[model samples]
Target: MLYAIAAVILSYLLGSVSFSIMAAKLVKGIDIRQHGSGNAGATNTLRVLGKGPGIIVFLLDIGKGIAAVLLGAALSGQSDWVPVLCGLAAIVGHNWPIWYRFKGGKGVATTVGVMATLAFIPALIAGIITILVIAITRYVSLGSLVFAVLTPIILVIMEASLPILLVSLILGIFSFIRHRTNIVKLWQGQENKLGAKKGQ
Candidate 1:
């Protein structure tokens, strides 16, 4: 029990490290949240900065998710729930990071990491379809929400463990909550496409 608790706390701390913010400040000496969509995530980084820094931050953020799950696996021994809970903690940290004044990104990239680690096959299937959605629609937020919704369905079809399914469902709820504004913009036909510049 103690190990599980420690893993979660450590995972949250790990997730709280915002690579996007670090990259922006290191490269351009700016607060990432003050620019573009005011999101401290990779997509916003790509928009406010460029492909170079954005891709790096994206990969690093994914790494953070992966690392947190592995840390849970290592610390919690044979417990299944520990890794799942740890993954959720990481996403929460990314969304409301303690280190960043509780203001952070939407946690999509982190979710990708956590899901991929917990259920690789389901995550892969949903991810492929999600990529297609983004490519065809040029709507990253829509694709993100799609991935969140599809993951648990795929898990149910595959007969995934209860903890995994529960985590996926919770992740989906978080995605919707985080993307509420984007959903509204999408409905109003005012959401920005993937490559759109600011105010476009």
Candidate 2:
């Protein structure tokens, strides 16, 4: 019981360290949450702060997820459910960070890191496919949607434990929810592309 509680709280804090918000504030003294689509994630970072900052935020966010999972596993050992629990903890943290008023990024990158650690091969393949699609379509939301939707399915196919699969599905659903605004913009043909705007 103590271990579980500690893991959960630790994971959430890890996730809540919104690197995008921090990067924006540090690099330009602006709140990432106050601009672009008002999202504290990579896409919005790209939209409001340009590519360099966006890339940095993306990597850092992914790093947080990876760090949390690695830490949980390292501390808890290769116990059956600790990895899954820690992964969930990281996702929850990113979605509702304590450090940032409980508002955080959409959890796509972090989720990727989570699965990649637990299910390395499948996550790698999914990540490759996702990146290809994003590169071709210039739609981060679509790529993320692909990542989210495919992750649990892949986990299931890989024969991960039912518990892991269940948690992964929940994480995927959360990713979709976070990307809701992006979905709207995608349909309306108003979503931002993955490059510098003209004259910028």
Please tell me which predicted candidate would have the highest lDDT against the true structure.
1
Q: What tens-digit string does per-residue lDDT give for candidate 2 at 1-200?
A: 56756776788788888888888898889987777667788777877788898788878878877777776776675575776787888888888888888887788888888888878887888899999998999887899999888878888788988866887788888988888877888899887767634110
In Å, residue 179's CA in model 1 sits off its true spot by 0.5
Question: Candidate 2 regions off by >4 Å?
Answer: 196-200
Per-residue lDDT for 43-109 in model 1, tens only?
9999989999889988988998999999999988889999999999999999999999999999999
Q: Count clashing residue pairs per candidate.
A: 0, 0
Best by TM-score, which number? 1
Q: Single out the weakest 10-residue window by summed lDDT for candidate 2.
A: 191-200
